[model samples]
Target chain A: MAARERDGLKAVPYRSAYRRVAWFVVGALLVLGPVVFTPYWLGLLTQVMVFAVLAMSLDILLGYTGLPSLGHAGLFGVAAYAVAVLSTAHHASFWVCVIGGIVAGTLVSAVFGLFVSHVRDVYFLMITLALGMVVWGLSYRWIPVTGGDNGISGIPRLESHAGLPVSGPTPVYYVTLAVLIVCGVLMARLVRSPFGYTLRGIRENEARMKSLGFNTWLHCYVSYVIAGAFASVAGVLWAYYNGFVGPTYVDLTASSEVFLMVTLGGPGTLVGPALGAGAIVLLKNVMSAYTHRWLLILGAVYIVTILGAPQGLWNLRVSSPPRGTRRTRR
Target chain B: MSWWRVALVVVIAGATLVATAQPVSPPIKLGFLAPLSGAYAQNGRDILNGLLLYLDEIGYRAAGRTIELLVEDDEAIPAVGLTKARKLVERDGVHVMAGALLSSTGYALAPYIDSMRIPMVYPVVSADDLTQRKRSKWIVRTGYSGSQPNHAFGEYAYRVLKLRKVATIALDYAFGWESVGGFERTFVADGGAVTQKIWCPVSVHDFAPYLTQVSRDVDAVYALVLGRAALQFMRQYREFGLKDRVLLIGAGTTTDEHVLPFMGDEALGVITALHYSAALDTPANRTFVAAYRARFRKIPSYYAESMYTGAKWLVAATESIHGHVEDRAALVDALRAVKVADLPRGPVELDAYGNPIENVYVRKVERVNGELQNTVIATFPKVSQFWKYNPSDYLKQPLYSR
Candidate 1:
């Protein structure tokens, strides 16, 4: 794949120009997607973007920090339920609900991080998986607050944005796009920071980073919380988009899906996870329409990815930037 | 030459207008939402098969318009149900909706269906509030509510059976609570005592602990275990030696046809209550049973019968309005006004709240031709979700809970 990319890059003199034009077209299409596509596609794309944010957040922990937190959906679902409960029960304003969701996500992440900071690899995975199941149980059994399995519904979308009405799927799509862009940029910067290099160093050799007088625990803990906060953002967007939250969001299946996104997208590359989220979401919603055996197709995709492209679809390209650079660079 | 060309153009325009003015009706799109793949896939498939059977019998044409069915799997998840609901309405532009299995999915979908002004008929969702306090004008239910049949069975257990002391064991969930509540309310009202009540989790694999707690002095044991738990509970009930001591009675689902074929002699002599049983001997039901068995090669459960009847009810309403389903309000009004007398489940009519008022059958698990079947022993005709209580008074009370 690398050799093919090198040959293609050499063969095409205007490769960068072509990339620039491609990006512009993609950006413009996304911005005006609601105008051209039906509301169904818009709603679907909004979901893809929301999940992309979540997958990117998981990438921060699993890809960058080498923390395989299987229970990441716990953080995501906490935020979603928090926002849903606040908006539906308290009738709180939109900003208050979003803030509450982020805080709830971050706080839970902090607590989970504190507990799992001492563990790594499989142990970390097991602990996170259990913690995620705990959240799922809470959501399913806490009937009064979470509405149990029926879930809390009829949550209004962003009622207003800076005095402009934001009532329909079209507006929701734009808001999700904006949030995705902001999260993508911030995550990109975070991954390239000195702190990021330190995480990679710890991932490479944690004992060496500790010998250099760095608080390796603090780095992992902070990154864990940060990833959770971003996941919460996605959760909040999802609550508003779907106007509902249920126990399924906190279950192990959801956690595995987000983890799958990171692995399938090229875990180390932030862009790769986002792309993977889009691919999986589209595959699910669209393919299921044609065949009920779409999950089997998904299983096939995962197996092929593991066997064929261990680095994910993104790094398969020769244009991938050198190591230690901004992860999104092509 | 100029005069002839002008006349020719006028004639072509006249012919085009006449061709376009012919009465051409669009096909009615029906969107079906259910858990097509998951733990509930069997029930979902049954529902789909039942509905298809009915449509097939009618030649898939309703009220002078062809029916175009669009099926989407919710995977038994509420969020997925809502997403599919959106896709069905916004993308596929289905004129009517039907086929949801879960009470949770029904509730999750009610608000959205109302907001979209798409008339939906639920065949199997039994959530009480869907037709009670949280009732929506756009939604109609042809299936019995969670406690509908249980209420009738409870009355029978006290009055006809003359049971004085009954102990109950039910799965710990909303459905279980509601089922037991109905039985308890009527039994206690009719001057019978409930000796003991035990609640088991839905994931419970063993019933020994709860079974051990059943009081020995009770005249009979009333249970509401469902799905896989039903088989396990029945087996353990016999294994623990209580089956010989006390009569085993339960909600119709405990020995429903879906799981009845797999049950050993453990299910024999069990009495239960449900709206529809394949063993019903009515002409309507006999025809339906024969057709459903021929098509699916299995006895139709309440789930299949409910959707089958629901499809008939939907078609009745659509035909009543001559297939003008494009008018949302008229379609919903037509649904509310439908009174089906010849459905496979017997006579069914929508009560004031748009839930079916149908017959609740008290069935006994009897061996017929060496196969266990729910034979209709007694029938409570025109049973409502409100049971015997006045609608207004029933609305004032809290939902049935343990």
Candidate 2:
């Protein structure tokens, strides 16, 4: 009964030109948006770009692995703390700290993923939630080390680039935009790869993939690690951009916000999640400029969006014109 | 357009707007860099509302020019603090930036603003470093320090209440660390023995663990929690039967505006060290309160009072600069000349570090006019965070560079 499909997910229609247009739009934004706007807007745009990276990471697990892990924020927080402590306490170089943060996030997610590989369906979400709480506890209790509730402040900013001090928000925006573009391209390529096809196969029918001599659990485990690694990069970027890291990064809301971005944008699409994240981050900042009841308004919008745009915001925005590689599952 | 063009356009447009927006007749541009969103939004908004009320009351113009406010939300995040600070100074082109409520955010933004040569009149932040150690050429505080209330609490404990044994239970953060450290040093020097210190993490929802660890022999407990934690601790502290056993004096902010009403009976009789007692009987205080009530239809907070002082001071400095704020040194000199003695919180002065050395009051919450208001029992001699004894010595201590 469980094996039967009442309806199958239709494959996404492929469009290379559409992909080019998206890239062009992103490029245009990087240059024109910063110059035409103020430093405040540039800084605000940078934050949107950061959250977009995080949304893309969650898409890996939800879209590729078909495992909707609810606790990705735990990985995000882990990477942030790793970077902050390593750079601030251990005095690690910037590159070393970034790499260290990614590695730490991967390790943490991998350990949890190993146990979670045994659980299926709702159990996966429950186990991930529990694991996320455990990480939060560790950050809180390890006060002497993590700086506890006060958060790790006075974190050094990117003082210079390649030994040259890059002054102004212009340089910082360019750097962040470049990183975001690179990450987007990599994610798109990953989704188009042979490995990606196999993961989709697992998402479609795990039992069938198992019968075909493929260990579906290994696929899920690997996806978690990759997603965790990507999330770590986002976390490290957040640490660098903010110049401070707090335990709130590890909380449920962080994970929930990421989850919202993916689901709200287009959970299974490569670029859709990023668009959703960018939209949310930008709007959240601008929304406060208008009213103090942002949370109330956000709550109302959440209720309205889930009802209206449940299929994803990208779908709503892009009319009937379709995009992405449509792989038919036989 | 190519990607490079997009990036260049954004940078140029933003910079252009900021530079050109500088001079407008009387040239008073007021910008508030408080958290208008996120966790501490309400507090920032409260101060923002209060200051705007004063602005409206004062006709929102000073130095013969209309005042323009550019507000940015710090979101109570330290990381967002400097970015917002930079954006306000560089892009929004705010001549005077004021009112960052979080001490950590103020501490983080102080150096960045100084480097840019924009004098920031910090409102709500009580971190001692913002004035003492982190003192900059372009920064001034119109608010009290984290330890101001503790200065009075020390005197009260010694002279009036006669409490010999005390214990501090504070959140494990900068505000917590500095407040408790300041209070303990003063209280202990006055022959009060601090028993055992308990540090609760900021995210803690329950105080059972901390309450269980409190020593039974302590004569009083100084609880330092703010935001939702304060409400939780108050209810729990009373429920745990600890209120009767020991005096539940706060480290000041725990029983402030946000948590006071929600805390109810548990908050009654509890003492807090605050710069503004909300019930100050002075004429300046009365007028400030009346204006605040008319504008926001609510009582003003210490946070709001500080923001008002900072805003008024910044406006006075703006008049001195005569709309030519681009001259960094001139602007710095203009800021140094700002003196607001008739402030809502009584007399406040800015020393070299730009921190306010003001009166610290010890007030007990009493039922008055069908509401719990801070009843001033004693006010300490005006104390500067550059402490009478230490005098910026503690500021000289190396900042936690790590």
Candidate 3:
């Protein structure tokens, strides 16, 4: 499982070009998603897009770098609730509310990331797991603001930017698409940059990066904050789309959902999680709608999907191999 | 295109084909915001059924205009419920809404009612703020008033049935707190000694931890929780042999049709206090019972009864204004003046505060005709919102003492 790379199909190195073409097609479809689906169906797809963003962001920490801090949902949930509280309670503009959510998710993750980046494997995971639980507990008990187990609701919608005539599903879909595109592009550029190499160096052997006289913690911490920012954007979309946020968003279960998404589409492929999220969310919605035994079916599907395609649903055969063994190419 | 590209395009085209089959509606559809797809799905489903029954019976016409309903499942999460409501009102253009079977959603959707001004006629949100002094006009209850069931239980237990001591175990929420709070006010005011109270959160799946927590000295244990959570609590309550030891009784939220069908022998012989017992001997009730049985192949719950009643009364109120609901003030006046002696719940009438003041029935759970339900034992006529003891004085504090 660890050996596969260059699109996780070690036999097919030129598959990177195929991956680019696949992404282009997916991007076009994403833009046309609203026209293709009704408000309800579009709403479900919007959730898929949101989680896709989350899973991609998580890829930075778990894939690009080996810091598998388990409490990513803490940032996600706080961002969601922060948007709700800020917009409804403080009457901040939607964009301001969103920035507030991003800042919150980043700062919260950064402080904890600073502390946890110093630790290795199990300790980092345990600290994050603990922090996630703490956030969940606070949200549950803090009835006045978080609305307790009830959650905060009735958040206002963000209107069109620059008089683009944004009012309904089409606008929200476009906005979400724009956010995902920008973040995806930014992540792609960041991963291909020298900083990306440093993060990969840390992942391969933090000892080597340190021996090279580089502060490895800074890279990991910086990537963690970036992931946190991306996650908070997803959170903002969730808050607006759902028009609410609760303690459950920050709970261990939510953290597990991210883990599931990532595992179903893991190991350094940026856009793989988006497909993974799409598969999981679509299967979940359709299966739940059809049968009473939906949870069982979902569990079975997750296991089957995981076992069948160890490299995730995206890495199934699409193209032939490159000529050379490997080349870190342009 | 290559085989892989063909497969990809086929997949996308398949998704598009699936998406286009469902038809969207006009009429600013009233969304039935409910937890219709989870454990509490039955209750939410029934509530939506009640709404649908109203829509069908009246030909989808309300106040001389066509009305369409769009139902969204909240799955009983406050966040999900809130999201569903906002989507219904904002994006879906639902004029009004109701449901989300959990009390947590009551508070979640409250601000949205104000935000939209679409006037959600809550099917079963008995939260105090919903009908208390801080009540919103946009939020009308076509269901049981929160404090009434508790006040009824307490009054019947202490004043009429002459029970001396009472204890309570309830979900910790506005519903549980208000239910028991209403009871404590009545029981304590009527020279009754209230022995104990237990407040459990919604997630406590097991009740054994708190079953023995109630003292054996109390006359009866008032069970206030409901749904699968309530079912689990009751099964364990009886399994521990405490049901026979201390008589289990409360506002009958669990003992009613919404949950009674779900609880077989576990709920046998439990006394409950409620406004609508499935056994209420009335022509309107019999019609309701028969129609509900025929439509859903199940007995109607008190929640269903109240919803049906609300619909019937809403129609009646509209007719009183001669179907000219074009005047908002007049419609409200008509709603306030509603009095139906022949409704399913027995002599339903709204007081000055728009809360229903109806007769209370004391029912003992006995399997009649192979189904567990509340059988009427006693009746109290014209029970008011302010019980023998006013909760405004008592509900001020968070918790009550011995």
Report lDDT per candidate: 0.86, 0.75, 0.73
Please give each candidate's TM-score.
Answer: 0.94, 0.84, 0.76
What DockQ does every candidate get? Answer: 0.56, 0.26, 0.23
**Model 1's lDDT to the true fold?**
0.86
Q: Which runs of model 1 end up more than 4 angstroms from their true locations? A: A1-15, A160-166, A319-330, B1-12, B191-196
Sorting all predicted structures by TM-score, with the top scorer first, yields 1, 2, 3
* DockQ class, candidate 1: medium
Q: Report the lDDT tens digits of candidate 2 across residue range A109-142.
A: 8898898877766888788888888888788668
Candidate 3 residue pairs in clash (backbone atoms < 3 Å): A242-B83
Considering chain A alone, report the TM-score of candidate 1 relative to the true chain A. Answer: 0.91
Best-matching candidate per TM-score? 1
Weakest ten-residue segment in model 2 chain A by summed lDDT: A1-10
Better of 1 and 3 by TM-score: 1
Model number with the top lDDT: 1
Instruction: For candidate 1, give the DockQ.
Output: 0.56
